[model samples]
Target chain A: MTYERPPTPGYDLGMSSSPIRKEVDGALLAFVARQRPNLLAISDELAPLMAALDALLAEGKRLRPAFCYWGWRAAGAVEEDLDGPPGERLHEGIVNAAASLELLQASALIHDDVMDSSDTRRGQPSMHRRFEALHRAQGWPGPARAFGEGTAILLGDLCLAWSGEMFETCGLDEERRRRGRAVYDLMRTEVMCGQYLDMLEGTRGEAAVDTALRVVEFKSAKYTIERPLHLGAALAGGAPEVSAALTGYGVPLGIAFQLRDDVLGVFGDPAETGKPAGDDLREGKRTVLVALTLERATPAQAAALQRRLGDPGLDRPGVDELRQIITDTGGLAACEAMIARYTGDAERVLAAAPVPEEARAALNALAVAATARRT
Target chain B: MTYERPPTPGYDLGMSSSPIRKEVDGALLAFVARQRPNLLAISDELAPLMAALDALLAEGKRLRPAFCYWGWRAAGAVEEDLDGPPGERLHEGIVNAAASLELLQASALIHDDVMDSSDTRRGQPSMHRRFEALHRAQGWPGPARAFGEGTAILLGDLCLAWSGEMFETCGLDEERRRRGRAVYDLMRTEVMCGQYLDMLEGTRGEAAVDTALRVVEFKSAKYTIERPLHLGAALAGGAPEVSAALTGYGVPLGIAFQLRDDVLGVFGDPAETGKPAGDDLREGKRTVLVALTLERATPAQAAALQRRLGDPGLDRPGVDELRQIITDTGGLAACEAMIARYTGDAERVLAAAPVPEEARAALNALAVAATARRT
Candidate 1:
């Protein structure tokens, strides 16, 4: 039974509640609601964890799930011999798989927030921050830091454990299940390795930029976009050639996504992004953009940049000065150009991929939309 | 085809390095060694994590794996029908499943140590403790605590992800594989839920002794014994009746095992247990023994005990006093009696189980040894 992406509804991006979008949303919502009872079953003893999961699940735009459905639909359309009702089972599997991705993402974000000491996420207090506030309100002894961190760590572990349960109950075929497991495993490993590289680079200083970027590619790009998309395509019975083509498209798009994210880290609005402006600066994140800036800057500029980077107490003026320095050193333009180059590469790959022309066009549009997302 | 445990060669428990035990050790060591090259294939970015995992895996006793193998053998002995060469395949599955259990335990411990602020485990520094020390040595800020918690969280996630991968690759029947997956899911959920209960009880500080005992049963017994044994038996095609029988035998044994652990926490020799003497006293862990003491103490003694509970800087004299009070109040004897009662109950359950006589006897002996071991 083949599937194809339903035709794009004639609507602008400003219309957040498009029917086509809602169709996918409705599917995911139905899946989540049905699974809600199961989640609640597990939630009985893990009420705080359940609340944290609810918050994390609420944050995503469901883009990965959408990609998975689209991939399945595109594959289904190519199977000429199958003429039957719309493949609801396939759609359900894709939705469940996609939801698992979101859960996995939540697990990572919870831990990442704790690791970065991030106070807010998706416009609300981060899990650790909320926990810290509770600790203070209860007047716990010693320090709020330990209690906050301990709760967040448990919450993250809870999410990881629940994600595994979700995957186990996904109800896919044996072969597909194994394939999905492999994809999920690789995704997890990449994110963790990427996180490790991110920490190591910050501690080891300027000597590790190249190593850090490679980590970014595997950790951020491969996990976030490349593998997930490939997993979807692979589940749709895409052959080796099709998977290779998707990888070609996915890698550059993934890189472009992270590159844009880096740009936002330095310059995005805090209100929209939901993180403090220059929060990355405060955390001293050693992104490729930052690495490039350091490499290209004059000694004085580099020293000035270094002074402001990772200073958690840095005020508005410090952030402004650092932003100005990055721009003056050509880091902003260089990053933007890199983003454009990668996006173009992704577009080129998509155009050359041997899928249906309509599917290719839809994927190209998704790549553009993803890379250009404002926040 | 039936499987049975190899006859126990009368080897000294303390110092004997018998060939049979060595063979089991060799199997595990060789499997891990062969996988070392594949471990290298894990990205260079995760080198430190891989190193940590290598060290952690080396420290485990392979106890669960041994039980799994025995469970398989015990079940095989009664099997009247077979589909394949049951010996090698069943043994391999048991070993892999067993290894996966150890990995899961390792993952849980890494996170648990961080949550409990525990500094030592298995005679060595906890993973988080090591990371925290590193953070401090590098002159990181006052809150090196987050780094420690974050690293441990990631390490646990990595272990869980890898454990799933290992299980997925285990060559087994599809139905049996699904059953195994279900067992794993339940085990993870139970542990997390149990952990939440533990934290909640500690925070509330009003948990009844019964409530504390329930937490121990769910958190330790169900997870450590019942589930692991049942998983192995199910993998070997043991009927539902067999699983029920195993659970009946496992539950009380597991509780007895934990009671012994609680006793060791307060009075174990520091050198043998690889922890400071009275470490649990310092941490104010509200074990069943402590609960018993609180119930039986005089009003003045109870007040004094409550004041010292959870005191981070609890002194040696305080530890000594609490120990004396428990003994003076007869709580120590009561606790010991409870342990003995559970051990006796475990023996009754084993006697009533429907397994082969010899296999049942062997399991009973192991249970007694496990719960009664002094360190």
Candidate 2:
């Protein structure tokens, strides 16, 4: 398996992330190292999975944790105001708490790639593909594909378990953890349900715009943003109102962020996106953009779009035709307009939010970087 | 799509199970039903997954929880002595905590089936096959196998999550849940790492007895028996010595239990075993039995054994031949001897255990049931 990969995402975020990155990476690295001996103590044969996880962790966007951290600040936590060892402990604790999300994200990405049958992730061979290659190279008995997928599934399960373990043991107080765990539980269930529904949507070529939008809502809006924000607020011992306000801002911004990703999946440069152009179209994902295009296309155009959308063998010409059809049908315009609208909705929520002044500014900047990221 | 299944596998416990089964099943059903509306709220497309999970839960042996419950009792919990409301709460809470193991077991079984590429489970289509059939029935647009595996992965993930969730929310006090969580987390990592190592064993036709036994120690001995017992002890606020004592009893009993399963996999009646006869041979599991057989076999017999071990097309004659060779080379006898030795070791531990009188009786019966079961 080639270990080569593009620069990890988040370097391009329009923020000074060097310190935050170090702390998050430290927490992630430490927690992962702690779990390693448990697996390796059983057999050194399990080392490959640890390596794969480390690589995936390195490439994570760290966006959810970023939102979670700012949500902590939004709940009236000014890091500079609290000075002492306990305060430092709180800082380290929250960083570790936020870092748990990265572990969860890595888990989702591994399993999601298998579900999508995508061979690569973030410019590297995907987790299952890596296992598949290892199996073939080792001349292992049985079907290499099954071995690959099976190991990937197991590794993903480990990450998911680790995510929760890290969150619970992040040195947070009992009360804070109790509150945060509710949000954590809800977030996990939402993603599981959303992913299953979204997979179903891929099979339904004629799925409606509402259906596609709901998948985005469950998979992206809540999972990517709302729940993370709520977790941070809860961990900070914020009252119900703080969680409610954050949700208002997080949901729409998350929708816009996902829309941006959908756009990049179709149109962005491979270097910028770390995925090949039109990857979503190849996966036959019934995104809101595709639903809009199907709604507006002529009968013949719609039929052609459906035929080519999920064809794994679709060539450059087919992608170009689909892109052109999507543009001519005004689906691209509608999607862009919706992103603008959702971003505006999020901005309105931020304007009236009870966030502390510095946190308000940080959240505003994050919304921009989130919805407008090129990668 | 077909929901017919074998009678759930706990009826022949060689003890009265009527009341215990009701409480455990009630806890499991309630917890699962509680989580269902959240998924259905996203879309009813998730209902099939729910149904699949329900069917799986129905068929689980519930043996882990039984071990755990007695572990609690072994630590001085007496149901009859606690007669008040608080006592009732403790009873219900422990039951719920015990029930969580079934969910975790369900998760492992689903993914294990996918990994093993097994078709039927408990006289019905395996979880992945159920989804594959659903895809074919619905004429879904993708590889049915991929879709099936993907959905099963997600559903299994849900069960894993729910298992932890149930444990945390089992209405036990903070001290109990906190201690229990550590065991739960360790149990998860052990099974994951162990399962991966065991899967690798399937590929290595020449894996030795020590290697195979190590897999059993991690995958079965610890995961199936020791950890669950530890979780119960910890939750009961047992002291360190109590935990250590239980471990002495648990580990060897668990090894014997797994060896029994290995024997049944090769020799038991399909109806009683809930698996096809000689199934382990077809799967090419490098069990201690196989390893021991190789250790004793002549060069020609070993080569013949390797050639036919993992061929999926092995018919009755091929299975019979392999069985004959295993017996000739003393593999089966060696395995039986090992099982008897482990069981004896466990019985000695129990005899010296500081268990309550009634719990001592129950624990002995469970050990017998576990290692001597036909199914």
Candidate 3:
């Protein structure tokens, strides 16, 4: 069921090759491997924890870290020139910051999968599902739900704790370290607040759609793109204006990324998305697409959708009908248009920013890839 | 139904004159009150979340933070020390660390409640129970259990994340910050390991008695007493040997503290403990007392005990029979004796530590008070 990614396009004409991405990934993998012994000593009973973490970590594309490294590079950092020594310390700092973003992403996913009650992620069984199976096999008390959640909660907390530990121990300059703290704090808080908004929208109905979108911007957009890029820029000792400019581009790009995800949630094939089609509809997820569909649906269609929404027993026909209604109402097209608008806006911002022309071209390519991702 | 605490002799020693505990408590409460606005801004949907966290935080005795502060004081930190100002900043550092401990404790409790599946904590409904109520009230889809767990897991993750933010943001000396990181990491890893061992013991049966004891030491002892005290001492720039000396005393005291809690889990009245009597027995918690009971019980008695060990449907008569078996086999007395031994050993360690005589007296008194608490 794994969908192979398309080959990456060539770098922009003006930009030269940099070993930043591979360097960051290598350092992070080595650091994590070094901590493995200590982690093993901590949980011999839960030996699978390490393996699970490794697998989850490996699934990520090092996009965030690349932004972090490029942020530094754009801030006038260069690798060892033929006549100069290597900037080992600066490179280390960039790698550390990059590694943190990946860790935070991993933490979010572990908790998110449990919150969404997802059965599969990245073409594999979800962590909660794996733990739930173990709970059932062992005949644990109360129900499998308790054990599944207990493990997920602990696992997420462990990731957060370790992420902080990594940030603290990453030998970065004092100024950059202080700057990084502000970004990290904002990112974590935003995610939590966004989660609260999402939950509220689900329960309170459509009265809060605007608020829900704001939550999406602050929570998912800021955390996923804007902040990661901002954090990397801050770590590279970028000027305040540079961070602001990056955010201008990153925010819209982040929105487009999530908007695309919402579309995929319903229309995406099960094999490619690693989720059953119309899963969000069955879960009653209050996404913008759902909101638009509700606003546009006929009275009869709206009533039928409402009846099926949040229904755990929703079957194939119900899913098909809901999808058809959404499509017929033009909600899908509107969502697609919104994604395109945001992507265009991000590219415009990038064009106006004072970044290197070559970097801008690469960044524009990244924006297109992110927004146009099919699965 | 309230069980009266025994009036221990010399319980009021220095209580009438001591202003240190009162000062620290005031500082902590004031800081928390000021931060209310910040917390409120982070969540509009999760109303229950803030309320539950507030209640849980309110219930903490601040015993760990108290130990930390005292450790600092014992290491020659004077109220008027010319080096650091006395008013807000220094106090905020200590309060932040204290608050971090409280938040960490909350994170552990949320996960533990899910793991244990008990209905109540601190004379109030547990977080999972609160979430379950919300699920039922809203008529949410799927089992209420899943919703309850999903909310609790997210809530706990938020607490862990917030705790790190607070710790990182707290203004403290670099040396002290480094020390704090070490203690925090150890504290987190130990608790998880301890939890793993605890879970394993329940499944492995009587053969894990020694392993269970080791779990108690790592999970409760090091975390509850040793680390907090060390963290506080280290913050005040206490010599490594000084904190080491406190550890010498804290470890045994922490073990005794857990031993007493284990005793209360079975024999203590529900009114005093705020949990149903023999709740641990019903849950089949594999405590030292349970291990002892199994070692001493006759084969027929052991069979009967095993039948009711994890029986959620065990009636009052069944619980009574289990209690009788524990008492008749002298397991209760043996447990009490063990508590006494550990407490006595803790006292000896306190006497042997290189602390000032006055500090030693205070620590000894605190140890006695901790071991003798009714709730």
Candidate 4:
């Protein structure tokens, strides 16, 4: 049965018709289309790989690219008139570069799904699952799961390399590319480390709140928000203070964004979030919310949470019981409060930053839309 | 219990103490050391991740960097006199840039080990196996295998990204790095696609000889040999013909090198190969040797080979049986002949190419050492 999404106010991730979002979509499609021939040149058997990548590339929020574009705007591109509307100042090369971040995100997601053995992504079968099914369907020999996992792993690797390749070939001059890549390189390393931390945290059982927050900081706050902004600022040749200010806003906002995602993973409708209900519960992600819940639970309640947490066979009733435990113990409220605080901090910092009015307004809109979304 | 390596007539990899090899080893250690602080800053837990990477980096053939260096030497760097020995012509920046290829190679090997589920690499526990032991030792929660694979996957990704970062930071000017990166980037994508094809071939059971040869073309010939030389030539700002000449030599030599590897996988001493005897057979690798054997085998022989192949639990007796079948069916002899033919082709092309005497000598020696060695 499909879990229906309740109506939420304002726009959604891929539903936004904004020019920046549209440009990112177009750039991603064009970039992927351009890369198809090389794989085909290797073998027609690689056609499935291209198809898998294409399907995964579709339907992103384009939020990272948005942050990047606004980062550049905040830095104030010298040739652009600050007085013009935001849509009027778009540069194709800059947008193309920003869109490359989506490829990085896709790579992370594909690998993450394999690590967690996830079945679904964005309401579709995960990359590994797709290959698993393909193997079964084709009556291929050997373990279907292994074949699927191998395909996903290799595809994830391809996406990782492609992200860098696409970024380099995005029609930017070598100087800009060289500069932007510093932040890009750091971003990749940080995210992988963050992932390692997240995986380690999981194995160690319930982690301290600080450990969970650290994962959020490295895996989400920096990778998703601060670095994208820094890449944009660096490309625009912005001042150090400009990058500093953007970091101030980006870090907090990025944390809030992830916290919201955490909430959605458990509570959001499967139809809206495009994931199975209680996926974090099933995977036993060491998010701050889980850490806080473990902190406040009584002995029996903690034991109960542990029994069902990370259980792949967890049923709907088990999910309800865990949700009840979290709510009763104030974990959910605490998580929401943290989100509010971080979002407020981001908004305040953004309000004070000396950015162009158009960028400022768009960023404010994005922050609200991101955090306030039910999904 | 261990197989002893028979002494070769001449110098072998990592033993000659050649200046180029020494430079590559030193550069790799220094580069990995420099990146350690950032990961430690993320979390002390990541210390193991770094250690795993360091241990894996400790020993390698370092062939890619050597190829890149020779490619540059062949192209004629304007600053260096071509009459000197290969060692004197080494530029630190260019060598460092070339050394970065080791990271890419490491990334591929780590992931390849995970995909193949091989327990050993370079005679040490494979990355996933190391993590598996760590998980068991620590008594971590969840399945130990999952944790091990996740760690390996993330580490492989870090190396992939680090390769690009190291390449950029290799002190080469933007023009050189940029030019070389085009080749580097293409090499990465091709190898991943090649890996995908290899995985697919394995699942499809015994495939056609053409399919197996295609895997060798993309996975080994281009990735291992051709691109590194092209990268070197491009960095030296060589003329178009220099790249073409290098490719003409590299492709055949690389094919020969892989054929040597396939033969070694079956027939070589485990000590020399640094892998288990019949590792490819255990993993069900659909090599050209396997394809040719199946083609030539009688029904009974083919059935006998199929029974033990890919059964991970196959013992020493099983390995011997498969080896006997391969030899009986003429697969081993055919593979040796192909290696001889390709090596001869490569040497002839190298002899005719308008390259400097010193470079020609080193490249010829490398070709001989690469194809003729037991390892």
If you superpose only chain B onto the true chain B, what TM-score does each candidate give?
Answer: 0.87, 0.94, 0.89, 0.93
Runs of candidate 3 exceeding 4 Å displacement:
A1-20, A70-88, A135-145, A204-209, A311-318, A356-359, B1-35, B39-43, B74-92, B134-145, B203-207, B313-317
- TM-scores of all predicted structures: 0.88, 0.94, 0.89, 0.94
Model 2: per-residue Cα lDDT over B121-212, one tens digit each: 87789999999999999996667887788888898888888888888888777778889999999999999999988888776555698888
lDDT of 4 at A125: 95
Q: How does chain A of candidate 4 score by TM-score against the true chain A?
A: 0.93
Which candidate would rank higher by lDDT, 1 or 2? 2
Candidate lDDT scores, in order, read 0.70, 0.83, 0.72, 0.84
Candidate 4 lDDT over residue span B248-310, tens digit each? 999999999898888888887887778888888887778888888898899999998888778
Write down the DockQ of candidate 4.
0.76
DockQ for each candidate? 0.41, 0.63, 0.36, 0.76
Residue A281 lDDT in candidate 1: 89
Off by over 4 Å in 1: A1-45, A69-88, A135-144, A207-209, B1-45, B66-88, B133-146, B315-318
Interface RMSD of each: 3.5, 1.4, 3.4, 1.0
Cα error, candidate 2, residue A220 (Å): 1.0
Query: lDDT: which candidate is best?
Result: 4
Q: What is the full ranking by TM-score, best candidate first?
A: 4, 2, 3, 1
What is candidate 3's TM-score against the reference? Answer: 0.89
lDDT of 2: 0.83
Candidate 4 lDDT at B227 equals 95
